[model samples]
Target: MKLNKHTVATRYAKAYYNLAEEHDCIKEAFDNMMDIRQIFGENPGLGLVLSDARLTLAQKRPIVDNLIKNFPELMQNFVLMIFDYDRMGDMELIVDEFEKLYDHKNRTILAKVTTAVPLTEAQKTRLADVFVKKLDGKKVIFDEVVDPEILGGVIIEAEHQIFDGSIRLNLETLKKQIAK
Candidate 1:
């Protein structure tokens, strides 16, 4: 059987998660993963450089070392292993998978909210509170996106569900009804 990218990433993520748990450093691992994820996300070129096929481990090690200069020894080693395996391209996916595993273990959910306008801190807190309740009181981690095309209202994505209250969507619905 051929293992796909997701399977490979998940395997690595689980292994790292287990190692962290065994060392009682899950929190530290989680924080480090977030930091690494953000770095990779913000600098796609860095991911490409680390994952470049022509680069030997010796070549990659220095780059990895510089990038993770202040990282905990465990995380630095784990990241180096990914580069060693030529799986640096999958770093983002691995981080995502790790977050999913951590969130599941912690009974938390990540919510993505898109709105036509920027939300105030109070609004964000209220939205989180509502989502927390909607998610059966699980802790909610919110990621907000501003999309003026929505015209008005908000759209939420959580646990494979979409709650769209956007004016654009409502207008489309009304249009369909009028056509009928």
Candidate 2:
């Protein structure tokens, strides 16, 4: 099968992840990836500029060099390698994949919770408790989103599964039942 963006990103990220693990610099690599990801994410045009075929390596070298100046040697090499391969445009996706791999290796899972209003510390703790049980004791990181459109209750999204208990969904279901 042909390789898509996600596929290519996963492949590169896995390689980088293994390298980081071998070097015992997973944390450092993660930090470097985050910094690079943020830089590209904020200045999207820079990736395009660096990835442009019209620009010779000589033209791009200084830019890449300045970008990775503060990075560890291994990370500096990784960043430069991406530029060398004309993969700068894919940096963000690779960073995202790397983050997932890192999180999995660290036994942490990300949860997105949507509620009608902001949750209190106690509510967050309770929700975390629920997910901790469901995730087999893996540590949970919560990303909370407050949406009044949900009406009430909460929706929990983790590992591609959604547990939606919002009043809006309940109302829709009830309306369908009544119509039938």
Candidate 3:
């Protein structure tokens, strides 16, 4: 059977998360994963090189080792294992899944907030406070976006739900009501 990337990533992330939990180094592990994600993101070709069939493990090992030399021993071993399993191409997905697990465990929610203009620090704080109450007291982290097309008002997306209060949406709703 062929396992999809998400399934593979989830499995690896869960295993790593469990290991981190067992060793009581969840925060450190999370930080290391973030660093790895950043490295892959900044050097997009690195994953491609690591996943290339032409490059033998011996050739890849030095690269992987250099990249992770400063990381904790457990993280270094975990990354080596990923390379061993030939899943280096899916490293980003694994990191994403690990982040989701970490956030859930920490009771943190990442909310994407869109506004016609950038929010001030005070506004951000207020929005986060409101979302915390709405999201069952989970700590809210904003991924703020500004889009003038919204015309006015805010649109918040969190936990698979969208709270759209944008003027554009409101105008559309009003137009529909008038047509009705």
Best by lDDT: 3
Q: Give the per-residue lDDT of model 3 (tens digit) for 1-180.
A: 999999999999999999999999999999999999999999988888999999898999899989989998999999999998999999999999999999988889999999999999999999899888988857998898999999999999998999999999999999999999
For candidate 1, lDDT tens digit of each residue in 1-180?
978889999999999999999999999999999999889878878878888879777888888888889999999889888977888888999999999999988879888999999999999889888888888857988898999999999999988999999999999999999999
lDDT (Cα, tens digit) per residue for candidate 2, span 70-137: 88899888888888778888888999999999998887879899999999999999889888888875
Query: Between prediction 1 and prediction 2, which has the larger lDDT?
Result: 1
Poorest 10 consecutive residues of model 3 by lDDT?
A: 129-138
Measured against the true structure, the TM-scores of the candidates, in listed sequence, are 0.77, 0.89, 0.94
Write down the RMSD of candidate 2 (Cα, Å).
2.0
Q: For candidate 3, what is the TM-score?
A: 0.94
* Best TM-score among the predictions, by candidate number: 3
Arrange candidates by TM-score, highest first: which order?
3, 2, 1
Model 3 misplaced regions, further than 4 Å: none
| Ranking of predictions according to lDDT | 3, 1, 2
Q: Rate the local accuracy (lDDT) of all candidates.
A: 0.91, 0.90, 0.94
The Cα error of candidate 2 at residue 12, in Å, is: 0.8
